[model samples]
Target: MEHNLSKHISGKFNQDLENVRNHVLAMGGLVEQQLNSALDAVSANDSEQARQVEKDDYKVNAMEVSIDEECTRIIAKRQPAASDLRLVVAIAKTIADLERIGDEARRIAQVALDSFSKEQQDLLVMIDNMGRQVSKMLHDVLDAFARMDVEAAFKVHKEDAKVDREYEALIRQIMTYMMEDPRSIPKIMALVWSVRSLERIGDRCQNIAEYVIYFVKGKDIRHISQEDIEKDILKL
Candidate 1:
């Protein structure tokens, strides 16, 4: 009878953990959609689409709150140890990153409402490319989390450098345009803000990748050198 009760408890705990994992994935999906929509708004310079993206941010915020409460409840009820504890901790941290990413997306949408001339449209192409790259990184990191694949997470981490380079290149191009034509300053400044938000979204995606590694290896690799991270990944 005691063994049967122990099995029942363990099964219940597993179910609860799975439930939380599913919720986190669902939240991630919503965040990804919000990001893509915001990027679309920027590409089209559509105020209505931007406003809709801003409104969608509330749903992301609500999911963050709900997921956090569920994690706290699981901790209090199950008193999980070891891997189970790590799972909950990683989920909580990832949710926080996702919420911040959503905020960045909303900022990008706000920038989209600004008017730009036809000459400035060429500049937007670069921003659109950057957004697409970061969107792919976000999608890949979420997949890594779902599969618990540390290798995939590491790939996403490495991809962040590319996003950073793209941002730098865009900045240089914008500065050149600003120097050549002072009249475009206002619109160029708005594009700068939008790209900055896109750059931040890339950073947030990297954070999610780090959480994926933590969930798989039970190791915290934040603030460490790439060399050290590579070494750790090799061990697994």
Candidate 2:
């Protein structure tokens, strides 16, 4: 959790950096709340709660724009170098992913607003379980980002594969459901899209994990395999 921000001579500069970092964490907290509420709506089948989640998405979007502007202002005014630059860059990227995660959460919430049959409810249960997995991943990655913990980031990075496996299995089961009951196609399509959104959220969490690694290690590890990350980056 400790960083080099205080090493700077100007106390104002240190405060500037600290302010931006805290804002990112606050934004992360809001995004986490949004995801949790969306999952709750799905599990409870509450259209009112789902609509509330939909309404709250604008808050997440606003935070992204505000943080982005702050980062730009820091770069222009402070002209930071080395680790400071990386921190700002990583944070800018992190907020973008978090906003997308918020969007996906809203999409997942939309599922509760639609009517599902008993069999479809079973599929939704599976989707809810998968969403819980992704939500945990998002939670862990955000914790990693807050601490600038590379090991924690790596751990969360590894969890995405489990989400992907669950996604594939659910897709197979859902596709079978669609093929057997063509009458349910319309509603089932919505479920399929929601599951897909959950999968995308998993990917975004992984991307944020990568940003954490980049910030701590000063390495751009995108498109690198997990084995390569552990072998080439993590070990160093």
Candidate 3:
């Protein structure tokens, strides 16, 4: 009877761990869907689709809260240490970034459907490309977490620099146009907001990549050197 009870408790604990993992993956799926919806809304200039993103923001917020609460409960009850602890802590931290990324994507969708004229629409091409790249980076980082693939995470981290450069050049080009013609103020401001939203997405990608190190090797990889990130990636 004692052996049977111990086996039952162990099985239940493993089941709870699996539940926690699924909750995180479900949250990831929701965010990925949000990004895709925002992209479609932007590309089509659909105000209804933009409204959908705005509506969906609440879901992401709620999921973040749920995951956070669940993690807290698991840590207190299970007393996980080492790698298990790292995974829980990393999820708790990364959920915030994921929520913020969802917000940024929704903001872009809103701004894309804003009252910009035809000419302003043409200039949104670069902004669109940046959005695609950032979304893919987010997806890739999540994949790394799923598989514990450190190399994939680092690749996402390095790719963010290109996004940053693109954003800088984009800002410069817009300012030049605005300077060349003062009458383009409102359109330029709208474009600026759009570009800023895309840039923010890239920033979140960088944060998520840093969390990957903690998820695997139990290290606070933030503010650490590139060489260290590379070394961790080499392990997977």
Candidate 4:
């Protein structure tokens, strides 16, 4: 976490890097808000809040583009090397993941605009439970990013498995419902898509966590098993 960002000869260069990093954290906060609001909309059946989440997606997209442009500008102008370059790369990747998480939140919000049956309410409850876990994961990863806490990032990475299990179990439940009443397929499909989005958000959170580990440890841990990460890379 002890990044030498202030070591550059040009104070402006240091400030520029700090600004871009702060913007990424700001973007993360916005995405987290969108996710929480989307989940609340579905749970409370508030179309108004859902529509608001839909409307605010553009903000996330805009931040991504802006931060990307800034990062590009930094590389072009300052020609950052070593850890500074890694910082920029990590910010780029993190923002991309945050934007996609926003998209997933929007997808989840769409389910709120439509009505569900009494029986289908159970499925929505399942979705909400999974959504909350994913939301917590997202929040934790962002906090990890802000503090450059590698251990926190690893914790979030391991948490994705729980979300996956929840997603798989929900899918099976939905499939069973569809089998009981063929007529419920269309409605069940909507729930299917929402749950899938939640699962994907969990994945994006894991990706951000990887970026954190990469930034701090300068190690590329993608495609590596958690056991391997702990036993090999993290043990260092």
Candidate 5:
């Protein structure tokens, strides 16, 4: 009789874990959609689309709270140990990152609402490219998390460096333009802010990939150097 009860409890715990995992994935899907909408709005300079993206942020925020609550409940009730506990913790962290990415998307949407001069249109093109790159990174990292693929996560981490270089190049170009014509400063500044937000989104995606590594290997590689991270991942 005791053995049967233990088995039943174990099954219930597994179900709860699966439920939370699904919730996180759902939240990730919503976040990805929000990002793409915001980027598209900016590229097309569509205020209505940008407004919709801004309004939808509330849904993402709500999902973050819901997922966190569910994770907390599972931890409190199940008292999961070892790998199970790691999974819960990683899910919670990933949700937090996703919520921040949502915030960044909203900021990008706000940029779309701003008035841009014809001269600034070319700059928006560069920002659009950055947005698309980060959006792809986010999509890839989420897939890695879903599959628990450490190798894929590592590849995503490397992609972040490319995004960083692109961001830097964009900033340099904008600065050059500002120096050439101070009158374009305001528009250029807005583009700079938008690019920065996209860069942050990339950072968040990288962080999520790191969490995937932690989930699979049970290692905390948050602050380690890239050299060390590469070595550690290779060892796996």
Candidate 6:
């Protein structure tokens, strides 16, 4: 038998869905703060700042858990359809991306702690720039989501190129250092992890941006290569 909700229950269900949206936005803010603090710690060479980043990791983790629980409750109790269902699904996915970004920030802090002596200013500069790019991507994607702006989301998808180029540059430098001085291999490896973590943060940001597009248009803009999206879809 198909279950039918009474009018009052349906209204309450809609309210519950809105709560999920709010919770997702809250989680996005927390992760973005962590990313900013991680960059600040790296740039400033402040151990105390790095420690603060580590401490804030729990807040992000908690947000992830809470959002996940809310999503489960909505799906079970509300059985929302159409856009409401889409919103809940998007919120769940966005929280996952934000949580992953938080994990990457924590990883960066750990890399800094392990790799820094007094300070590695050159490496710190690169990491700060990388974090900044990732932060901007996340911020714009979140804005795109709140507004349901597909164009803004697509822009984020394109902006990922800068992060990719930076990651490749870091890889080259790492390989060169390893080849020239075998003694630097251990430190170079640490740098490699830090840089890769930053790049993965960018990827998670892109993933969230795509979610905005999907929720708005219900398109699986993912897995469709850039060329296809531009030449195939946009052209049509």
Scored by lDDT, the top model is 4
Candidates 1 and 5 compared by TM-score, better number: 5
Please estimate how well model 2 matches the true structure, expressed as its whole-model Cα lDDT. Answer: 0.88
Enumerate residue pairs that collide in model 2: none
Q: What digit string (tens of lDDT, one per residue) describes model 3 on residues 17-104?
A: 5676678778887888888788777777788988999999999999999989998898889887666666677778778888988888
lDDT of each: 0.85, 0.88, 0.76, 0.91, 0.87, 0.77
lDDT of 2 by residue, 96-135 (tens): 9989999999998998898777767899889889988988
98 Cα displacement, candidate 6 (Å): 0.7
- Candidate 1 local lDDT, 1-93, one digit each (tens): 001112223565888877888888999999899889988998898999999999989999999999999999999998987777878888999
Off by over 4 Å in 5: 1-10
Query: Given candidate 4, what's the lDDT at residue 10?
Result: 52
Kindly report which residue stretches of model 6 are placed more than 4 angstroms away from their true locations once superposed. Answer: 1-12, 114-120, 230-236
Q: Count the backbone clashes (under 3 Å) in each candidate.
A: 0, 0, 0, 0, 0, 0
Q: How far does residue 124 in candidate 5 sit from its true spot (Å)?
A: 0.6
How should the candidates be ordered by TM-score, best one leading? 4, 2, 5, 1, 3, 6
Q: Each prediction's TM-score against the native?
A: 0.92, 0.95, 0.88, 0.95, 0.93, 0.87
Scanning candidate 3 in windows of ten residues, the lowest lDDT window is: 1-10
Full-model lDDT, candidate 6: 0.77
lDDT of 5 by residue, 120-227 (tens): 788889889889999999999998888777888888988999999999999999999899999888767878888999999999999998888887777888888778
Instruction: Give residue 183's lDDT in candidate 1 (0 to 100).
Output: 84
Query: Candidate 6: worst 10 consecutive residues by lDDT?
Result: 1-10
